[model samples]
Target chain A: MTTGSPGNNTPLIEARGLHTFYGDSHILHGIDITIHKSETVSLIGRNGMGKTTTLRTLIGLAPPRQGTIKVHGRDIKKSKVHKIVHQGIAYVPDDRGIFPNLSLYENLIMAARSGPNGRDDWPLSRVLDLFPRLKERMGHMGNQLSGGEQQMLTIGRALMTNPDLILLDEATEGLAPKLRKIIWAVIKQIKKAGIATVIVDKDIKTLLEISDRNIIIEKGKIIYDGDSEKLIKEPEILKKYVGV
Target chain B: MEFSFYLIQLLNGIQYGFLLFLVASGLTLVFGIMDVINLAHGSFYMIGAYLAFWLTGIFGSLFLGIVLAIPLAVALGFVVERLAIAYLYKKGHLHQVLLTYALILIFDEAQRFLWGNDSHGVDIPAALSGSITLTDIQVYPVYRLFVSFVCIVIGVGMFYVIQKTKLGMTIRAGASNRQMTQALGINIERLFTIVFSLGVGLAAFAGMIAAPIDSLYPGMGDNILIISLVVVVIGGIGSIKGAFVGAMIIGVSSIFGKTLFPSMASIVVYAMMAGILIWKPQGLFKSA
Candidate 1:
């Protein structure tokens, strides 16, 4: 029910009154989120604040106990994860989740798919252009890549699916400062390409710089959701909700 | 034993190893990709041999019987996966073990009821029925060599499919992480059914080939199930390369034990499995 961006008219993903649970333990209590097309939205919070859970729910890794998830205005709460990908949502978990036995090229090519409506927007050449290291280590196994390389590969792999939107959880949880800069640069390039993204990372300042809007979550509820300028203007909300 | 006799035994071991590879390839894939421990896999092999025998008798051609048998076995595999194996996917390994073990019993009884309780012989194809003279006192059967060659070709074919193709990529991804692969838009459920059927087909193919050598009997599967498990364990649970190396090691070691130490021959495969399991625990070819 909240609109963060006025100019962005199209809603790519909308979650209404989502109630998610892990076994008997309730994790998300009726949280709602709206991500418009070509927008970068950040979910910034302390650990275990339902950020990852929200992302998980959207992609059907963990289906919500109650409420609705709509992709492109269609109900997708009951859809499987693979079907959800066709709905234009791609998820990259915190662990990177690369297949260690697969080669670098295999990793990228395995998830290789045309964009929504069979649009050949993102291809191997374009992906390799963004991260040329993937090309150099094309024959290298996934486990052999450095942390930074793995992060790049994970993002690149998701893009191979030619998704309309990507969900990145802890995109730079563990990385060198140089690698962090590279990832933020990539995110910027992704934004320039007109793809929507939902990001979850701990670096609030840099995350604020890359994202169009911010949502502060506390104990599974959205305490504050607003533009970055408004978020920066209010320090008490950040401290109270996200401990920043 | 003379030098020619020793040479013949070595060939025999390699041939046995090849046959084991064919059976274990399916077992390992089912274990690796579908994440299911199919205890009834050996039943497919037994039934395949029986089917081969019945078909060869009816068609009166060994080659035709083999040609007709593969797709039928594959169909059987598909039907079995859809009916029973699909339900046990979410259950524990204990459940899988029990259910598939029960399946073994069912298949065993069904085969006996259908084919009767006597061991039946299958004639070797005419093309491979002759033997080459090795020494003044010894001659080697051509059929065993042909079996080894066929198995090697299949093994190589399996490698190409798993390592070099797009479907292989999906399978590897599925095997390593099921949730992530599904999230990547691969229809893993359909893939599982296909993989299960292929695995069964491979096991049954091994059965078809070995029918002439091993003959068809009720309890043939009981020992093979255990031995194939040994191969899967020895090669690392889910690796095809591991299965090949494990099969070769088993093939060579069993024959060596039989020739060198008659008392240890029967237990050699078990001993190797136990020792290797203790050492690597993940098997010989634990690749990334």
Candidate 2:
């Protein structure tokens, strides 16, 4: 698949000088990152290094103590989660955040809405088509699904919102190899559909193969941000930072 | 007991149960979705009854009084949720209880200042004032039957909305996971306001409808509050279906206890609650 290149088009999301803390412990220390239209960026880092915090801050789940976050060039540093989402962003948390009380159909249909400026690119039918596995379990409650199916349902639910960008945390954790391939293929399809994505996954090889740009975070700071192809050539950087 | 006597008691029990269901349903949903232990829920019921009594005098019709009173009750609910209950969402249950208990006191004082402490009786609508003769010496008031019928209609409507509508789906989702609901672009704060107001409306509506059958007085909400809490516990904390079943059980059991064992009438409902808890610690239905 052809990847998005750096252009003069306005970026989808931009964060500068993010300083986020959890209670007394400061997690993110002045991290800056940018995502462009139709771009796929992989947020790669070792565990507890602030990849999740970065996504959470960008989505407004974890507000930075001192920073500016802009979506489509509009400042939204203090916006609530729902308001930020209305600007065409969806977040699939690491836990997969499925509502156990709701069935598969309810889960998808509940989030069905046109994107910003009434963009209806991803509908319920389109999402179901993307994951036929989900279509079969429409009547099943969210808790009844296996780990792989829950992940698909979460992704499908996000698409139902018709978002311009999606932040996926731990997209393929604990899934069998076959299920991982299916999830990767779906991610590729999502990229083809021209929706920008920031994926945090443990698979370095898969990340290199699919992402347009790669960013490495070390202790809440952006240590590396460059082309994916170039990052693949530098094994020492991956070993020293990502522990791959 | 004669067949006619048993029949009258049975109808009375069912009617009382229906009224209790209205209050208990709101209590359960509010607790389930918002996680707020509102000790003042019954205050809405008291306000509803007083509103019915006061408005009926002005409107010259019980039906009109109820209709006008509904919106007022809903507005009060909205204001209370925004000004008070909204802050208690993250607070511990102890704080929630303290704040809401304080609200009960405030509402009681407000009621006294506005409507006085005298007991008031609401006249049944002239159209429903007549009674239906079941036997030679047994008769049932049409208004009581009307209350039951209205409750049944509302119950069915509630079931339809909760089971079939998108709003209901979102409500269930909100109850299950509030954070995820927001992540889906849902304005959850708005949804919480709606739920809280609706709960208040339902509780107040129950009070309004029951006013014609039961005498209205200050602190009338206190007894119903305890009873409704029991129903909530019996039905499970957040299950509407459980509330319905639990309310009906208590309603009938209390009526029978009053008739058959007058000395133990008060203890019957408590005993039943104890037995049920011993058997099913989670209540009759699982929390939604």
Residue A159, candidate 2: C-alpha displacement in angstroms: 0.4
CAPRI quality of model 1: medium
**Taking the tens digit of each residue's C-alpha lDDT, what string does model 2 give over A1-244?**
2222233577889889999999999999999999998889999999999999999999888899998998888899989999999888999999999988889999999999888877787878889899999888999998999999999999999988888899999999999999999999999999999888999999989998999999999999999999888998998999999888
TM-scores computed on chain B for all candidates: 0.97, 0.98
In terms of docking quality, how is candidate 2 classified?
A: high
Candidate 1 lDDT at B148 equals: 94
* Best candidate, DockQ: 2
Best by lDDT: 2
Give candidate 1 misplaced runs (Cα > 4 Å): A1-10
Worst 10 residues of 2 chain A by lDDT: A1-10
DockQ of each: 0.67, 0.80
Every candidate's lDDT: 0.88, 0.92
lDDT of 2 by residue, B135-215 (tens): 888899999999999999999999888878999998888878888899999998898899889989999999999999999
